[model samples]
Target: MQAYKLAEQALVGKRNADTVALAMYFVPQPVSRKDGFRRTVNIKANPMGFATGSNLNFDLGLPKLMAKAKPVFCEAFRLEGHYESKSGYPTTVSVQSDSDGDFKVVSMQRLFPNVSQDSLQQLHGELAQQYASAIKAGIAKLEMKTPRVELRFMHPIMIQGAGAGSDEASKLFQAHWQQGWMEFKGKNIGLLGAMKTVADHNKNSVPACKPQVLTLN
Candidate 1:
């Protein structure tokens, strides 16, 4: 029994190593704020997904393993959310990886895409309706039926990797941490825990198995 349990744990670790990962340049957009409590919503739209099946050159993007973001729907359930572009950039936002080791900036680019004012106006109109519809329905998720017409025009910055070594990657990550630049949705979670949550979602196909507040201690 002991040997079997050990083997099982190792197997689980291996599976997570491949399926879980981190995002750079952009992260998940959590909608629905509260007075006190906070909830992380895993939406169904990511940069890679938007780029994929389209002519958009977001190849600096770490390709999303799945074709579509699967927001787990619930009636009493909170909203399923995904990532959105917060900043397009000449900044240091990078796609971090740890398959072989920790703190590797897998890819990045100097400049991210910038949206045009006309497109922003269009986005404002679409997003206004999008949020209003969700709020009116008393849910916190974007409806799939509605087209995200705005994104087609709003181009985000490109991220290209420089092929840094593990040590250099670790140093870069450390600098970000010291500067308080890195953020994880869960209060006490970090990169590894976040990926573990991703793996859990991949393994379990139920709402109960979703990634919630996690603490690494």
Candidate 2:
């Protein structure tokens, strides 16, 4: 149920929840009495009586849920809102049609070319070991795309459907991912690690990390 709602919200965002911000959905727990299971008596209903979904608190936990569900972009150029990479957030993201009503997300790109949810779940489980800080702060939304076209022999796709087979397509995708929280975990020192250097620096002490220079040869 939680996963369903998470995916649902990735598409609809705050639109539907806004309509039900005032309601509350109660999942009453069972308690053991001196005889058997005890239940509640007549709970007061709203003045309008029970609507189909009038008892749910759709406005709850949106932030944490969104933070957990990464933004997925399967196709290029589907981004309807601005992605803020440096800041780790998105703005005005496009939503699927309201008529579908199940609240499923089909356009959000939050994974890489071959990455799977199972792999992510495993990686997330390991967060407590080496990436404890990321686990505590939450893993940044990931981007696992080619990000651009290379002139290698195995290449087969075009740059955003353009004939140009350079790094332009990857750069464009990076621009979109950059608009949100793009996670870099494998190597290259990464943007987050670089930024942390400034935070970890001091005038009086030695640096915790050394400089690394990278070049694409």
Candidate 3:
């Protein structure tokens, strides 16, 4: 599967590299049926405008970007590749690996220590409603037979293990994450599960999104 390949790639030069983060969404329909459902992966080396911290986070700018690029998916599978933050830094989320092939994420219920979870959930619900309205309007304008799309934002953490003494800090820091794609058929779905995380500055591992079939009607 795509997740397996991405995990392998993350470990290519850096052995300890384990976890990866991803943001899944939809893209514009392709030109032809032959192009519909074909998957692509894009590497983002530029830095993003998101703020960093212990938990996954997002910036006001991200939604603006999404609003500008309204994507819809009918049906789509997953794909993988290298990507980085818009700020030219590593992928957003980072964490410590509890064991091989398994990682923990900051629970959605506890994203911000100061804010109550109920309030955050309510806020996200409102946002999703607004996004859904916008996405519906956007998708309505597309031509029939426009294949669904899955636009992903990939963030992988490639760091040097403690005591390795590689002295290639710049090269390691220059390491990248991925943005990926996929497509299919449907009315288009929208769901917001998690925001990307910051680079694992403490040499901590990050988290990986398990491949899943997500559909929003």
Candidate 4:
């Protein structure tokens, strides 16, 4: 079966579980542009309830399923988004990076049932390893049509504060912004990484805020 088809099927199977929504193959154009690449493909599989604003989360087992099936799909596409939640939401398993080279998983939220901190970290590490392996294998076989594209995960601070046009309230808490980016086989990856580091420094140097902005890139 095709990789996307397999991913879609896996997503459908997982959606039958509790409040779980899966969005597979999310290719953001801005991310591509930031990395100096243009993507012609976008693939995704979002769980049904997410669009309706239902409280849906991913089944913890879905990653296992995705891992098992990813070999097939990764050949044509790169997996992105929260493997454990919907877009812009907190999740125990999240995938980021564009379709070309770099990808990272942030399993910060212990939202999965029966998941411990140690176990979550272990899972995160394992997923990262597996994804790297899959991507390498996929790239070896596939033909990249466009100029190699990298993804720059933007910091909310870059788009907010001082000259960013954000309001006083946003600028006041801009120090709380955190960001990261992955460099595919393209440029600006280093720029994005530097931005994230600077943002983290700014956040840490300032006094804590009561309610700070937490934007994940």
The candidate that wins on TM-score is 4
All candidates' TM-scores? 0.19, 0.17, 0.16, 0.23
Q: By lDDT, who's the top model here?
A: 4
- Residue-level lDDT of model 4, residues 81-183, one tens digit each, is 3322353222223333323212333223222222265655555455445444222322111222133212122233223222223354344323323333332
Each model's Cα RMSD: 19.6, 22.0, 23.4, 21.9
Writing each residue's lDDT as its tens digit, candidate 1 over 1-217 gives: 3323322232332323222331221233433332211223333444233321111111232334222222221111111212334652222223332222122332222222234656545655666565553223222222222221221110011111221345544344334333221333223454445445444544455434344667896
Regions of candidate 4 where Cα sits further than 4 Å from its true position: 1-57, 74-93, 97-103, 106-186, 189-217
Q: How far is candidate 3 from the true structure (C-alpha RMSD, Å)?
A: 23.4
TM-score of 1: 0.19
**Would you list the clashing residue pairs of candidate 4?**
19-56, 19-57, 20-57, 22-45, 22-47, 23-45, 24-44, 24-45, 25-43
Off by over 4 Å in 2: 1-165, 185-217
Minimum summed lDDT over a 10-residue window in model 1 is located at 151-160
- From the highest lDDT down, the ranking of the candidates is 4, 1, 2, 3
List runs of model 1 lying over 4 Å from the truth. Answer: 1-113, 137-217
Number of clashing pairs per prediction, in order: 14, 19, 23, 9
What tens digits encode model 3's per-residue C-alpha lDDT throughout 70-185? 22211122211122445332222322222222232211110111135565455455544544432232221112222221222112221112112233422332232112111101
Error of 1 at 75 (Å): 26
